[model samples]
Target: MSKYDIALERIDAAHKDDPTTITINTTTLPYELHYAQQMTLYLERLDPNASELLRLAIRAQHLRRWEIPRSSYPATKIGYHSWRGALQREQAALVEKICVESGYTEAEAARIGALVRKADLRKGDPDTQTLEDVACLVFLDDQFDKFEKDLGDEDKIVDILRKTWGKMSEAGRSEALKIKLSERGECVGTEGFGWLSVK
Candidate 1:
């Protein structure tokens, strides 16, 4: 197998042991593994010409995420942010290790690590931006319906959509516009996220 395939295999193996399962289309998969697959699909749709490093980073974005439950952190905004930051570091380290073991050079591994950690998001790094775009698209497409149901507040839902919209690139926003929201989410998308509509 190629180095990229080998690295992906290692990442999938780690996810296979997640111990948390989600059923999709009658097929059960470890939640993080399913999530990784979604990220890769969105990355391919968003930028088919993405580099090998970016591809690796996207595939391992949430590697073994179930290992670090949000409940382990304090129940506060600060704690939530802290937990997310730490998870980013942990995922980056794991992906970097896998990349090196799969024949990537140290520099390439570090680049993938940075992308996993989302370094320089506001600095306009193309790979990091693309990763962020793919993430936003995944959330909008796959998670928004469940998330909206849980929140039960239209204003909060729109706020979340607006925040998510702000993080995406024009291309990402265009993709987001195509998502078929539930009735409540559709209202917010039409009223608040309408600005994202392509001409």
Candidate 2:
């Protein structure tokens, strides 16, 4: 079974009737912001109001739970847990930015950030809830709102990966790359989101 399959199973067992799917709501967030584009697409199909932060947290939770590495998990959840402490630090700075931008006290912004992190870091919510999970979940949900309506035939599943294959979580993207290379005899040329093209 694939790495995604393991996470999927865990997610399924954890959120069986809890509605793990996210919905698309571009009014709140956008597709480009979601790091995991495809998974974001998946969530948006489920719920429009899905919070990106919550998604990130859950994914992080999953990673901690399964002990899956960045290379194995989908691109969205890669390095997710490792960046948690950094994300918290950045949010502290963001709180200051928000304070300056909104004319609020730095303390107030800090409080808000604290609440967000507290709520986001639900210990029992998932096995490895993370900030990246929240980011991707929210990002994907936002993107799905705009893109899902355009989806066509189910018979043809075409994944145009915009992220580096190496970063994909649960080896999703790498698995895809290997399959495509072996089946199509092509090699991907570059890195990041922009350089991908079937050869």
Candidate 3:
């Protein structure tokens, strides 16, 4: 197999350890593995010609995420941000190791690590933007309905969706509009928030 294939295999191996399993279309999959697959699918839709490094970064987006649960930190917003930052750092390091093991040069591996951490996200790098867009698309397409139902707070759901929407590029937002959200999801950002009319 190629180096890319080897690296991808290693990433999926790590994801396979996730204890959290979710059933989708009658197939049970480790949650992070499923999430990674969704990220790749959306990346293909958003940028079919995505580079090797970006593809590897996307595949390892949530590498071994269950190792650090949200409950490990406080329930405050600061805690959430802290936990997310930690996850990004950890995932980046882990994927960098995998890239090197799969025969990538140190520089290439480090580049993939930066992509995983979204280090240039604020700089408007096209690859980083595509990664962010894929992440948002996955959340909306694969997780939003269940998340909305579980939260059971329309206001909170809208707030969360608004924040998620704010992170996407115009292409991402356009793709999000095509997702078939649940009835409740369809109502979000449409009542009065003219800035985010997903419907």
Candidate 4:
């Protein structure tokens, strides 16, 4: 959503270490290959709750390409658009599939899917409280290890969730428990992006 360097520098100063915010952050690392690594670090550092969701949404917004400026890309515009659509479907499908598996009504699943998509867009909007907002950031050093890694044992998710939640704000902690509960005592599958892990 940002085009200028000044705006990005401001965001970078705020969330450079928290890479999930890297997407909306118009900084030096915006186009870096290690962007995923930073993103994973940010997510792993935060629990999958409102605060984390807020960060995810910000990253998603950056990932969502409204249009690829012709100057920046001479060709492959159509292909890029198609690729973006594929990713969008993949994101929506994950929510829909999870909702259905959780026994959500058809209408409910649809609503949640829509909500999830909208949430992503919200992060890109300038008027909103960004992922860099103090509300979403709670510093707990070495707190990232609690969350399950893609290659980690799934059983570790439970302990990770517990430890991760412990590092969050009260509201974030509450939502973290809710997500784990929704998993039905199970763990989120470590597939695809796998919490945006770098390796």
Number of the top-ranking candidate, with TM-score as the measure: 3
| Residues 1-199, model 3: lDDT tens digits | 9999999999999999999999979999999999999999999899999999999999999999999899999999999999999999999999999999999999999999999999999998989999999999999889988898999887888788878889999999989888887766677657624444635
TM-score of each: 0.94, 0.27, 0.95, 0.27
Best by lDDT: 3
TM-score for candidate 3: 0.95
**Can you give the lDDT of residue 53 in candidate 2?**
33
Whole-model Cα lDDT per candidate? Answer: 0.88, 0.36, 0.90, 0.38
Tell me how far the alpha carbon of residue 17 in candidate 2 is from the true structure, in angstroms, after superposition. Answer: 38
Q: Tell me, what's the RMSD of every candidate?
A: 1.6, 16.4, 1.4, 19.4
Off by over 4 Å in 4: 1-75, 104-108, 115-199
Clashes found in each candidate (C-alpha, N, C closer than 3 A)? 0, 35, 0, 0
Lowest lDDT 10-residue stretch of candidate 2: 180-189
Instruction: Count backbone clashes in candidate 2.
Output: 35
Residue range 2-41, candidate 2, lDDT tens digits = 4334433443343333322444553433222223344444
lDDT of 2 at 157: 16
lDDT, candidate 4, at 181: 21
lDDT of 1 by residue, 53-150 (tens): 99999999988888888999999999999999999999999999999999999999999999999997989998899999999988988888889889
> Candidate 4 residues 1-199, lDDT tens each?
3222332333333333433323344554433223423443445445344432344333433232323332343357686666655655654555455445545556655544444355343445321223322222321222233333443665565444444443444443432332322232232422321322211
* Model 1 stretches with alpha carbons more than 4 Å out: 192-199
Angstrom error at residue 5, model 2:
43
lDDT of 4: 0.38
What is the number of residue pairs that collide in model 3? 0
Score residue 15 of candidate 4 by CA lDDT.
36
